[model samples]
Target: MATARHARPKELENASLEEIMDRYVARYADRRADWAAFEDAKIEGYKRAQHRFIGAGGSGKHNDVSAIPAGNFTLSIMYVPPGQGNAAHTHEVEEVFFVLQGHLDVFVQDEDGRKISKRLGPWECISCPAGVIHGYDNNSLEPVYFQVMLGRGKPETMGYADDDLYKRRDEHLKAVS
Candidate 1:
């Protein structure tokens, strides 16, 4: 007697074409910016928002869910207004930033507090190693846009390199609370 062939799962077999298509496509208009992740206008810098398309980055917020589920990495776009950017922070996984528009000044600081900065124009990219404290700044008058990809799907909260900045952030949170 011949055995029956294995059948596909019911969910997969019953899924509509549109459902499958939607899972693979993500439009820019459909994305929303999460402003709560970075700056609050209290600090001199650190005013940026992230648009997630692959996964919720290290922001520790589930607000942004990408159309494509992240397996080994997370992808997101960051919008940094002129003169504003993220503060120096370290991650356990590798983080890369690809400049899409305007100019960005990427900087990394060593444990001894020495910092090295680089300028990245459109189509430029920078990859920061794990546990390195790095940050970005848009010194130009025009706004800067960049794509950020972390090695891990679910990254941990960023560890600020500047003790003063961390303390100030904590104090600000306390005041608001």
Candidate 2:
């Protein structure tokens, strides 16, 4: 049995078969990745990919009818190759990472530059509050997979914590263009 916190809309309950099917189904094959946005072999050492199933994520791409648009939050899966991870960045909205496979080390940096990190195994989860500078790394030899849930339907752009890395990313883009 399933329950909803709020009553279901009469219109939705009475929707046509095709409309109902379209509203509820999302297939894995339809997923697309913005590999160039984050993973550039020359700019960064790690190769991380984000698969948007629910929303376009903070990058602002792939927000089409094909994707299940998020109303209050966004959900996506991340594929991180061994020895690959994300650069330190901050988000205006809360961000959560739930480990589904392999090992991951999540690091958090405070305003004063003090940093701390923790390791997450399968089925583990960690939440970084709004405006917290955090990043993830896969230290294991095996690839790591995790689900990312953001607090907002359309999150603001991520703020890179390291100024040098941010500048480097901009320069790299300019050079490639």
Candidate 3:
């Protein structure tokens, strides 16, 4: 009478404890720093790096074999330098940012482009709903480190506010390795 949700996967069910741990555990030192910018970040002011830990974490690197397999969501550590940030964009699923260090000026916008900004320091967080345009800036003197998560294990590429960027959103996909 056990349901699939409660059943152990065949791959893990027969594996040794060490094998299970090897497949599930992701060490921080082994993570790769991927700076594969999204379409909008190709602009002069927007740039950042993503250290993938689980799934692609919305960077569209779904083929990254080194990352721990994601179940329901994706996770990554974002590094944003001073005066740099992401442009307004939206995804098919909700996105969350939990600031781990430095200050990030985050904002969310309505359909008409009306936006509200807030300064988030360490331990602060924000959840941007699906289809809402949101972004962040590192106005502080130092770089900002933050954890990012997306609702889906492999969400679609984000939709940029700018027509050009939106049109080229999938360009980053081809460049991802």
Query: Please, what is the whole-model Cα lDDT of each candidate in the order they appear?
Result: 0.77, 0.75, 0.86
- Which segments of candidate 3 are over 4 A away from where they belong? 1-5
Clashing pairs in model 1? none
Model 1 stretches with alpha carbons more than 4 Å out? 1-17, 39-42, 164-177
Candidate 1 similarity to native, TM-score? 0.80
Model 2, range 103-147, lDDT digits (tens) per residue?
999999987889899999999999999988998888889998899
- State each model's C-alpha RMSD to the native: 5.3, 4.3, 2.9
Which residue pairs in candidate 3 have backbone atoms (N, alpha carbon, C) closer than 3 angstroms, thus clashing?
Answer: none
lDDT of 3: 0.86
Question: Candidate 2, which ten residues in sequence have the lowest lDDT sum?
Answer: 168-177
Q: Per-prediction count of colliding residue pairs?
A: 0, 0, 0
In candidate 2, residue 133 scores what lDDT? 95
Structural similarity to truth (TM-score) of each candidate: 0.80, 0.80, 0.91
lDDT of 1 by residue, 38-76 (tens): 423346687788788887666644444453666688888
Better-scoring candidate (lDDT), 1 or 3: 3
